[model samples]
Target: MSLDLPDLRTDLETLAEAHGITGAVVAFAAGDEVAEAATGVLNSRTGHPATTGSLFQIGSVAKAWTATLVMQLVDEGRLDLDQSAQSVLPGLALPDPVTIRQLLAHTGGFEGDVFVDTGRGDDAIEKLVALLGEVPRLSPPGAVWSYNNAGYVVLGRVVEVLRGVPYNQALRTHLIGPLGLTRTATSADEAILYSTAVGHAGGEPVPTWSLMRSNDPAGSSLAMTARDLLTFARAHLSDGAGVLPARLARMMREPQVTLPDLGRPSRWGLGWELQEWAGGTVVGHDGSTPGQAAVLKLVPEAGVAAVLLTNGGDPDPLVAELVAPVLSRIAGVVPPAPPTPPDPPLPFVVERYAGRYVSDVMAWEVAGDDEGRLWVTVTPLGAMAAHGGSQTFELVRLRQDTFVFAQARGGVHSAVAFLGEGERARYLHTGRLNVRRSL
Candidate 1:
């Protein structure tokens, strides 16, 4: 499994160019053998080169780190996964009871995408948690699986209350510090001290460098080099080197809930996304920030792990081009092919899916024309509107209640699904669950 470092760097540069990736870091490990490579620029404006030690925004992948810290508390018998989230934080108001495990598994059911900038104080997460009372409960707790950013913030608060420290400090003290990751950055300010990659969009630098401090638990400001990311991944592979308990690490990879195939994970572990590849199982997570994206994939059965970090351009193809070969050679793993549209678009039962789905941050409408053509319109609202403007997508049936975007946008053929029965969709699932016509 030993790698030729020079060849890997050359190959990575070639693949990045092929995929239009402006800059990236690629790292892979097979037990004793490890190789890391970097290519392109940190910022298009500055033209700083991406290097082996360069940090890129890891985004929601920080959720995995947050979850690991929570698991450390669980390992010490300080917190029970089944305990109600409200019970841990005495005055925390929840519409319905939500368990610690529910928050970790994203089954907490409350409006989970509540990203508000409380401030740059240690009390930021506490402030965001206090505002959860105003957030509506989308579904009964533990009844569904939705990607919940707000839920992670709540988990961060749980860590804060239990560990008796701020969320960012707790992460460093527990996970980051314990793993001996010298290059991991807990905040954007800290990341700037290192050679950090700035996020870019459409081949240009993104105006904003970071999100609000309140969202730190959900990975708003965390950044790390690919090699450091691999080191963290290795902790799971090697029992956390006296930090994370082996049982908890194994438990994190154990499937807690099955997810509807929307072109990503097949199941959800405590904090990890579990994908079933042809070779075996790959437990991992993916991240996306303003203009940066990252992915951490691990094949524990093969004693193999890999990380891809990118700033700007089309990274999806770069991921496939760069990650698959190393994984395949080491573990005989094959990623599921990206879902493609049928040669002739298949017809769907319009009544089953045509409905308006609404959430606090985004609204979506599915409609069918007289010719039975399907279309989806999305409007970002309030705080979320700043990220993007409205856009319409043409969809073709993939299966019951599921449709794939007729064309790939941002190098992904995004899938959208409706949940319900008979004639009408009761919910819309595009990662986060949106209720039908519920405001």
Candidate 2:
């Protein structure tokens, strides 16, 4: 399959500028053939042009790497997916029922989005788990799917304890070094040694370049180039001989849970999100940090993979638009179409839906404007609330119980569903489910 690399580069550059992105890198792999392109500047402040080798924070996409490491331990008989996290890290305070597999699958049913800075010390993950002692369990283990950040941190602790080393060292010795991913680093300190992209928020460069040390395993700590990311994806597409057995790699892509709120792929595997598109099964993960967004995707049947790493602006839409054409033209994989609202749209009683919903980390106050339109004011609670503050957006009704919010930043649309009917509705579901609080 011949690819017009120059044409693809031009298209990517145009898309990046249209999105206000500071830096962008894209890489594609088809068996032995590989192609890559970069556009914009690494940092507006530095005026450095992004190259194919420029590293960008891959965010939660690194979760698949961490999962791969955990699977390697499983391959060695050093860890059991069903083993309780508390048993592995005896000092850790997670619920005993929360198994290693649940953590990997984001089904541990615990408060998962905790992002407290545990400091720059080597014991950061340990300290971060120590802080988990006070976090309330959101649901029973293996009950439901929630994008759990804290669960991955616990998994990181599992790696450290089982490997008898820090999370960073364990990742390096077991995965990064052996896989020959020279551009990938576990923390900002090591990443600084390479040509890197500085993250940006809005149109301004981000003040901080890295996440808290504790987020290393959860993806806040790793940085890599688009080429390296696709390389990793390609390894997963084949028998991961040195890194993981082909069977285990295949296991990681098996559907573990259904993600109803997330329309695409709508199901998750061990670490990969399973998107059963019309073309084929494209397994991958996306990552987002303060001012960076990254996406890594692979079409296994086609033996093809692609990755996009960006420093700033809303790269989600750009990824949606860019990856489809690349995959279709290069790998003969047709991308899924964007979801549309139901015909005639479902109607709901606005009066009953308007109320205060509360959760461990955030709160949502749903009310109506004088113009009879509904709006939700989201307030982040706890430490996250202190940092991210609050955001209010008007909700466009899509169904009797569902509405979509076009977020201010990237004009990204997110669905909000009210479970139950009228005043009997018990919860409001958005990134995570928030139970309705009493009046």
Candidate 3:
């Protein structure tokens, strides 16, 4: 694969220009040396031109690093992926039987913490646990995948308890120090002299990261530079840096669950998102903090990885625009841009499923539209757009009957499954609230 550097640079600049991004420092590596680039003003107001060394919050992309630390424990046999969360941190008393692997992959049912900055140290972990004590489990352990910030708080506590050190210190000793990442730190509160970016909400001041300084390892707040992030991604691609072994890196990159019907069909690995792009797997994580957004992606088979960081409201479209061209240039594969799907038509056989069904806990009504599409008005007004089913109520027979409801940014919030014969449908969400057709 050959890379045309000049053309790629123009594309990047064009993307940054489109996003009103005043500053962007980007780096690309392909199993060899770092090829870097920068653009715009690091501080638009003061007119500080962004440089190759400019730093930004890596956001949840920090999860890959945290997962690596957890794997270090796994390699040492101190933590078991299959063991219950209770087994690892007995004092926390999590409500489910979630295992360490689930936490890594977000398969655990632990509720996510909505409070952003609880504080950056042990107190953050304590507040998170207190909050978790009151939040109910969405599903049984391992039954479904829910991205849990609170779960990572538990992971931070586990790291602290087992290593007998602050989670930040442990991250340093295990990851940043070994990798010689001078600019990376778990604490957002630390005063680093590098050019920094601030986060905002709707162009207004929101809580800065320090507000909820977390020992949490899920990358709620880890500050780093674009070059450092590219270095981290490259290391995982070839296992060259020796920070994490190749096998452990794959474990983090391998898809543990399939999230279909997203704006795209993606997979969730251990703290990483996996997608089959071009001819291989593109493994990475995306992070968002108030005024900041970051994405770190590495295509291992193609041997290229890229990182993009921005301080503003939306970073995804801009990041995607930046990386797509680089991926084509370096991989020599012009990947197909995702095609927008047209409005889905109503099911041809929706009448058979109309009825009231009772399950162990939940109840719902299923009816047909004039277009013959299945419409489920859940007892609590859980309306879903059904794709496929039979008028005889053979929902499970239709793969399209399954529906996943996700959050604002496309994170899967809950899934509803309707599978069964006419008037005898089995409906479920996160494996809880089973809804069946009333006979």
* lDDT at residue 377 of model 2 (Cα atoms): 88
Per residue, candidate 3 scores C-alpha lDDT tens digits across 5-119 of 7655566678777766655666777767567777766444566666777777776777777777787888788988778767866666667677888887777765564454465
**Where does candidate 1 have its weakest 10-residue lDDT segment?**
1-10
- Report the error of model 1 at residue 163, Å: 1.2
Compute the lDDT for candidate 2: 0.81
Alpha-carbon local distance difference test for all models: 0.87, 0.81, 0.63
Candidate 1 Cα lDDT to native: 0.87
lDDT of 3: 0.63
For model 3, give the 10-residue run with minimal summed lDDT: 381-390
lDDT of 2 by residue, 272-361 (tens): 888877768888899987788898888888888888889988887677678768888777777665545454545556777888988777
Question: After superposition, which runs of candidate 3 have C-alpha atoms over 4 Å from their true positions?
Answer: 1-3, 200-211, 332-339, 347-439
Judging by TM-score against the true structure, name the best candidate: 1
Summed over model 2, clashes come to 1
Worst 10 residues of 2 by lDDT: 405-414
Superposition error at 361 for model 2 (Å): 3.7
Model with the higher lDDT, candidate 2 or 3:
2
C-alpha RMSD in Å of predicted model 2 compared with the true structure: 2.3
Clashes of 3: 17
Q: Which residues of candidate 1, in runs, are more than 4 Å off?
A: 4-6
